[model samples]
Every structure is written in C-alpha cells, then in structure tokens.
Target: MKTSFSSEFAKRYGLYALVTGASEGIGRCFAEELAKAGVNVVLVARREDLLHTLATHLEGTYGVLCPVIGADLASPEQVEDVFQITDQIDVGLIVCNAGFGTAGNFLDGDIDTELNMLSLNCVAVTRMVHHFGLKFKHKGRGGVVLLSSIVATQGVARSAHYAATKAYIQSLGEGLQQEWHGSGVDLLIVAPGPVETGFAKRSNIQLGKSESPDVIARQSLKALGRQKVIRPGVLAKVLSLALSTAPRWLRIKIMSSIMGSMTKQLPQ
Candidate 1:
C-alpha cells in the first residue's frame, strides 16, 4: 500500500469500527462499506457462521481486516463481551443496528419475544451509545448511527411495539446529537422506511419497492460527520412528512391498511 495519509493514518490508528447485526441488513452494509473505506471492521451478530462469512468477504474484497464476534446484544453479558473486545482498539465508528420486529396486533408476538425486540432495539442502542459516547469524548472524535424507522414518526397500529422501539431510538438519537455537538461525537438516527433485505422475511414484513441496504448504508455514512437524522429513500421521507400532518385516526387507519396487505403475504 502506498504510504498516503489515509494508509498512514489507518496503520497508525489501526482504524476500527464496530457494527452490530452485521450478518445482514443495514449493519451488514455498514461493515462492508466501512471496510471498503479502509476501516478495519469488527462485525457482531448472533450467527457466528454467517458473520464469519461476511467478515471473510469483506477482507477478501475490500482488503480491510474484518473480525467477527458472535453475540446476542439483547443479553447484558453478551453486550459486555462486545465492549471487552473493543477495550484496546480505538473504534472511530459504531453502528447500532441490531433489531427485529413483529407486525399485527401487539399480542401477535409473545411477551418474551416483545422483550427481546425491546432489549435489542431500544436498550441495546442506548448501551452502545453510552459506552461509545464516553469513549469518543475521551478520544476526541467518533460517530454513532442508530437504526430507527419511518414508522417511528407515528403510532403504526399494526406495529405498535415495533414502532415504539424505533421511536425510542429516534428520540435518543436527537437528544444525543444535540447534547454531543462540539463534543466530537456525531449521532445519526436512520429512519429507513422499507429496506430490501431478509429483514422482511425474518420479521415477516412485506414492503414493496423497498430501498437496498447499500443505498441506506451510503446515505447513512454521508450523514455521519454531520448533524442530521436520515431516512433511506425519498418516498419514505415524503411519507413520513405527510403522515406528520395527517390526523391521528386517519394515519392509523392508513398504516393498518398497509400492514394488512403486508400480512396477507406472510405465512398464516
């Protein structure tokens, strides 16, 4: 490698990044995109084999070292383990994107399942920001991105719990961004309407004309180093703004109708 400023800085700093849920979706995109930018990536996911494959692909294709950590972020112990691995590295970027959702009535998923989603979406995001925010403060520079949702702007009846969790992420991102400004840490709240990833299959969601993970990931990185919340697609942005002015009952009805169509596509 030529000893350019980038290569020199990367070598001296050992450019590091931590991306949760890296086996798929936005987090996977985050890992690949960062590696493509010459950042050594540490990908965390529950599926060891899948993450290992992703890690190898990034290293082989991007020529950036990618390591995998098998972790269920919903567990405090696992979250701690993730932090321990980063203790010695100067992680300049942290992408908290580990989350899952269940549609239909709030009762569609069991309470235990709901808790898992809550833990992963809201609690885990806060924990990652807390740890990395402090580290960033001490290190003097860093960026954080949290995956929120366009549904977070309103109370989507069919995805009650799911919307609430994303809302928490959105709220946290806004507050942290404001509070951390000039403090050397940038916070990005990503509200992607519908991403074309296995998330639809895993979460049993059906979204037509969804954005790709790469599209969202690129938009997210652009938003970083700047103070702005992000939404993946123009259509999603328009929908979120239109819904903001819509009557509560009407919006719920509209969301419920859309969700109803989605549910019809899923297995019974």
Candidate 2:
C-alpha cells in the first residue's frame, strides 16, 4: 500500500506475481493490490469465467497484464501444470492463498471433502513453494507468503481439520524460513483472527469478529520484508501468545467452546 513498497515490489516482480484463489475473498484482494502496485498478476482459481472477467477488468483499469490459470489445486496434476505455466514467467513473488474450510466434525462431513481441503490447503501450498521457492532461490530473489489462521495456535473443536491445517502452515513457514537462511528467499506466514470475507457465511459461522479481507491483504503485503509471524490485530497477537504458552487443557477448552458454539450452524 505504501508508495515505496509498491514501487519496489513491482520492480522486483517485473510484471509477474501469482495469486491463487483469485476468484474472490482475500485472494481477490491480493490480485488487486498487486496490480495497483504495478505488478502483472496471474490469477488462479477453479472458475475460468470469473478469472477471465477479472483479468479484463484489471487489465483495462490498471494497465497490468492479468493472466488466468484455471485449475483445481486439490489435484496434483493440475498443480503441476500451473507450475509449468509459471515456470517461464519472471515471478518474483507468490501468494499461495488458495484454500477452503469446513464447519463441522471430521466424520460428520464427507470424507472426500476433508481430503480435498487438505490437498488444497497443505499439499498444494508445499508443492508450489517447492517449485517456485527453488527457482526463486536459484535466481537469488523472491518472496513467498502463506495464509494461515489464528486458530492454528490452539486446538479448536468444530474446525478440527481446518485448525490443524493452519497449524501446519505456521510450522512449515517458520521451519522454511530457518532452512532458507541467507538464501535470499523471503517467506512470510500470516495469521488473522477473523475476516469479514463471508467465509463465515459460507461455513455458516455467525460470529462478527471478522475483519475485511482487503485489510488482511494489505497487512500481509506490508509484512513481506519482515521475518516474523504477522497477525492483523493486537487481539490476534495476544491470542497467539496465550495459546503458545498457556496450559494445554485451558487452551483446548477455550477453543473447543468457541468453535463448538460456532459450529451450531452446521448439521447435527
């Protein structure tokens, strides 16, 4: 959002940044923000028509090239194909933000749905990072960001799978940062408490603690050069710290209660 960062990010990217899940929500914000910053973006999502429409709008308004890459991230072959497409682009940045969550117990939901969530949230992220990260490192310049959740800090009840998947992001990000030390590869993991992106509505979560997805995207971009866990608010930071140091039982109990209440909207 800052003029300096935008200029620099655009310069580094040289008209190429990949934003997954660009159909809507936080992913859409990432694409728009990147375009505003003067970086050409390749939007990836399952919806081809949405991507095409967005591409036209972005190109017409920002004068930045907006390419659409349609693929189901839950599929490894599709994920590989995306990498091949991006392999030649001067992609100095990547926002691997394509992910979804369910609002019910493990067994209460369809088994295939849970597996799809895992593949998209965890496996695709790791694989794409592996693909782009290696290339970025070889080029000696690039930044990668992973979208995580505040719930990752503790065990929550209804969001059993979602919480764990986000936890994996937190751990993976921290670990990769260490492994890539002095490698000129930047990795940032963002954990936001809640966003007003209507993910809650989609999951039937009624809580109003949601922040705007645009705000989250801005904060995430601002935290790019910094190496640390980025949270959007003081409450998010406090919760993360508390969950990290608090007694296991207490943390679990609190998260369980909150998530349990939230999941009341789901099937019984």
Task: Point to the candidate with the largest TM-score.
Answer: 2
lDDT of residue 208 for candidate 1 = 78
Residue range 1-268, candidate 2, lDDT tens digits? 2356567876554558899999989999989888877788999999989999989988888888888999999999999999888877888889999988877777788878888889999999999999999888988888899999888877778888889999899899999999988887889898987777747776657674667788888888888877567987655767667778778788888887877887776776
Worst ten in a row by lDDT for model 1: 1-10
TM-scores for the candidates = 0.91, 0.93
Clashing residue pairs in candidate 2 (N, C-alpha, C atoms within 3 angstroms): 196-211
The Cα local distance difference test for each model comes to 0.81, 0.84
Please report the TM-score between candidate 2 and the true structure.
0.93
75-124 per-residue lDDT for model 1 (tens digits): 98899999998888778788898899888677656899889999999888
Clashes of each: 0, 1
- Window of ten residues with lowest summed lDDT in model 2: 1-10
